[model samples]
Target chain A: GDSVTQTEGLVTVTEGLPVKLNCTYQTTYLTIAFFWYVQYLNEAPQVLLKSSTDNKRTEHQGFHATLHKSSSSFHLQKSSAQLSDSALYYCALMAGNTGKLIFGLGTTLQVQP
Target chain B: ETAVFQTPNYHVTQVGNEVSFNCKQTLGHDTMYWYKQDSKKLLKIMFSYNNKQLIVNETVPRRFSPQSSDKAHLNLRIKSVEPEDSAVYLCASSFYEQYFGPGTRLTVL
Candidate 1:
């Protein structure tokens, strides 16, 4: 069985500060992809970033994540966090062409101004 | 900005009652999926349909079923709702990256 794990339950940061939400996964499949989805209050979760290449960093909307196959981690990071960046972040895993996703317990990011 | 749409943002029903949630996607995706988000914000895939054919079915209860009229629509129906079924039901469509619709919150009293 494949599983994703988010170590942090809730991460709070002051506006403009650096932020990181840890995400790791365990899978038996060799070809796997990772994704980050953000869900705001009363909104649907959207794709923030995704990666399938190992050790390659992917960035979108100022958020960046690098998938490291050796470590089995794809931690999301941002240099400067904004107030609007507050949301529930989920780390997902999908194997090959299978569209079904295995999601982790989401991490709620709260940015305070 | 989401192309996927779900009807009835929220629904309140009683135990043993039947409930159905409708989902439609205009993204022209071949695959549509149903996901359940529990109170803890843990998401789990319940069902997935590709080209109007069932492809993935997780170990869900027999009372739960997925109805897809076509590639753009996938509806979920619960034969007899249970208190444990009270959660957010999300509809998504994808060929690779999934696009989600605003979830429908279900409350079973």
Candidate 2:
């Protein structure tokens, strides 16, 4: 019954503008870790950031995300969006030690120049 | 830097046909997973193998099965493919964070 939700299916932003992709999850397990994965067109999805500690920010490749247990969210954010940042982003949750990932319906980011 | 590998970048088969996909990871990870990415790019876990043992089996159809010969190799087979099975199959291996393969795109016509 665990699930992840990405509210936006597509987010368009101008280059050099701030952007945020919302991610929220509901899980029955106690131990959990959240991940933000980015996939370019015709490429494999790669980890952008991962965090298990609640309220701690995890960042990679100019993108950052903070896991908030109180809100049950781990939203990915970037201060200045670039043309190269246009890609499909996925939010995933790993519950317990099972190694199974519950992924959200991905959000496609289109940064216009 | 791509440690996970999957065979057959693309596949096209008729409905009811059988198909198999091969996946290998050079990361030496004990946990390997198979995920289905639908046309909407929604990802769902299908199966997971840990050290050659079946750990997670999602509520998928019986035609779908996972084969693991070793910790590094995990294969997926569909006995009778359906039209709805047309999607991208992603192979991943993980210790803490998952590393995904290029994925095998399946088109069942």
Candidate 3:
């Protein structure tokens, strides 16, 4: 069985400050991919970043994450937070041959001005 | 613009009532999925259909059934809804990456 764990329930930071949302996962299969999804108010979750290569930093929309296989971690980070970054972030692991994505309980990030 | 579409942005029903949610995608993707998001915003996959064929069925209740008429449409039917059935149902279609639709919020009274 594969599972994703997000330690933060809620993270608040002032705009223009650095931010990090912790994500770690466990899987039986070696060939697995990790994804980060962001859901805004009243909107569906969208793919923020995805990675399968170990230690490769994937970046999108000013957000970056590096998948570390040794640590089983793919932490999303932003150099500077924007007010628009307030949303629910989910860490998901895609495993098995069925294309099932196991998602972690989301972390709500609120960027305050 | 939304590539995937879901009808009835909101639904309200009583316990023991039957409910169905509709989902369609225009992305021409071969696989479609149904995910449930609870109040705590935990997104869980319930069902997945690839090319109108059931590929993955999670540990969901027997009351839950997924219907797919074609590759683009996949609907969910609940035979007897319970209070704990209240949540947001999201439909998604995937090629390499999954794209989700605005979910249907279900409230079982």
Candidate 4:
């Protein structure tokens, strides 16, 4: 079984501040892949970052996340949050042969200027 | 830069009617998937197809079916739609990372 949990429902941050969106996953398969997707209003979810190798960091669009197998987490981080960075973020896992994604409930980020 | 395309960007239909949505992928990938996003903005996997074989989500109702004529086309059909079925349906393709279509917004009244 594979599942993802992003415990934050909403996060409001001031511009230029640091931001983190917590993501933790549970998987029976040892070989698992993690992904972070960003979905803006009226648009489909787009892949922001992904990583399969544990302990390695993956980054895109000024956001970075490290897959730490020891902690079973791949929390997303941004050093300087911008207003345009506001969107709903989802953490997903690809664990089995089906290639089906197990997605988190999502966390909404609101960046204030 | 888009690899997937979905038809019927927006649809409003009666609760008891049947509706079909089309999805096509040009990424040359063997796997395609359909996901549902509810009004709450929660995403859930609905169906998947690989090399023309259907893999449906166990929780999906029998009334919801997937039809694939070729490796690149996956169409979704919903029979006797319910108000709860109103949501955004996204089509995606996977080649290590999944690429998504713009999505089709369905409104069941």
Candidate 5:
């Protein structure tokens, strides 16, 4: 069984501050791909970033995440958080082309101005 | 900017009733998935159809069934819905990445 564990339920940050949403996973599969998805209110969760290459940092929309297989982590980070960045963040795992995602409970990011 | 469309944004039905939620994707994707978001906001995979074939059936209950008529459409039918079935059902398409619909909210009384 594959599983993903996120930092916590709620993460509040002041606007323009650095943010990091921790994510770590456990899987029996050898090759693993990880994803970070953001879901706004009443909206579908959209892929924010993804990576499979271990130790390589993947960046998108001013966010970056590195898949560290040795550490079993793919923590999402942003240098400067915006108010609009308030949303639910999910970390998911996939092995090969199965397309079946094992997701974490999700972390609600609330950036206050 | 929705590539996926789910019919009946909201539905309220009594227990033991039957309900269907339709999903269509115009993204020209080969895979479509049904996900259940519980009241606690924990999203779980229910079913997945790839190229109109059933591929992944996560430990979903037998009461819930998924049918795909074509590559673009996947519908969920719940026979004799129960109170525990109340949740937001989401339809998604996978083209390397997943594109999701707004989701259908199902409430069982």
Candidate 6:
């Protein structure tokens, strides 16, 4: 079965500090793409970054993630965390062209000022 | 910015009742999906429709069903809802990247 794992349930960081949210996946499908979605309080989840090429970094809104095929990891990172960055982050994997997404248990990021 | 739309931002229903949530996408996408977000924010795919055809049906309860009128519209219906069905239902449409609708929060009491 295809599955995604986000190790941290919650990650707190001071504003302007570096932050990283770990994500790993296990899938039998050969063609797949990884995505990071951010959901603010009372809002819909939106794509933060997406990548299918292994070892290539995909970035959006000051956040970046690189997909490592060998390790089956696509970790999200940001150099300077902002208070607005506090939200629930989800890691998802889409295998082939099925359009089905396997999402990980989200990680809540709380950036304190 | 919201290409995907869902009706009834929130709903409260009693157990064993039936409820339906409507979803529509203006992105002209051929693929639509339904995902359940639990209290712990654990998202799981419930069903997917591609070009008005069922594509992916996860191991969800038999009480749940998906209805597709066209490529842009996908509706979810829960028959005899259970208390455990209380969660956020997110509707999404995608070509390569999925765009989600403002989820409908279901509270089954």
Highest DockQ scorer:
1
Please give the TM-score that candidate 1 achieves against the real structure.
Answer: 0.98
Interface Cα root-mean-square deviation for all models: 0.6, 0.7, 0.7, 0.7, 0.8, 0.7
Candidate 1, residues A1-113, lDDT tens digits: the string is: 78899999999999999999999999999999999999999999999999999999899999999999999999999999999999999999997678779898999999999
What is the C-alpha local distance difference test score of candidate 5? 0.94
Model 6 chain B: weakest 10-residue lDDT segment is B40-49
- For residues B5-59, could you state the per-residue lDDT of candidate 3 as single tens digits? 9988999999999999999999999999999999988888999999999998989
- For candidate 3, the per-residue lDDT at B5 reads 99
The CAPRI class of candidate 3 is high
Instruction: Give stretches of model 6 more than 4 Å off.
Output: none
Q: Regarding lDDT, does 4 or 6 come out ahead?
A: 6
Q: How would you class the docking of model 1?
A: high
- Model 5 lDDT per residue over A1-113, tens place: 68899969999999999999999999999977899999999888999999989899999999999999989999999999999999999999987678889899999999999
- Give the lDDT of residue A26 in candidate 6: 97
TM-score of each: 0.98, 0.97, 0.97, 0.97, 0.97, 0.97
How do the residues A6-103 of candidate 4 rate in per-residue lDDT, one tens digit apiece? 99999999999999999999988988888999999888799999999989988898999999999999999999999999999999998966677899
Q: Once model 1 is optimally superposed onto the true structure by TM-score, how far is the C-alpha of residue A113 displaced, in angstroms? A: 1.9
Candidate 5 regions with alpha-carbon error over 4 angstroms: none
Q: What value does the lDDT take at residue B51 in candidate 6?
A: 97
Flag the better candidate by lDDT, 2 or 4. Answer: 2
DockQ of 1: 0.92
DockQ class, candidate 4? high
lDDT tens per residue, model 4, B26-87: 98989889999999889998988887987656588888998999989999999989999999
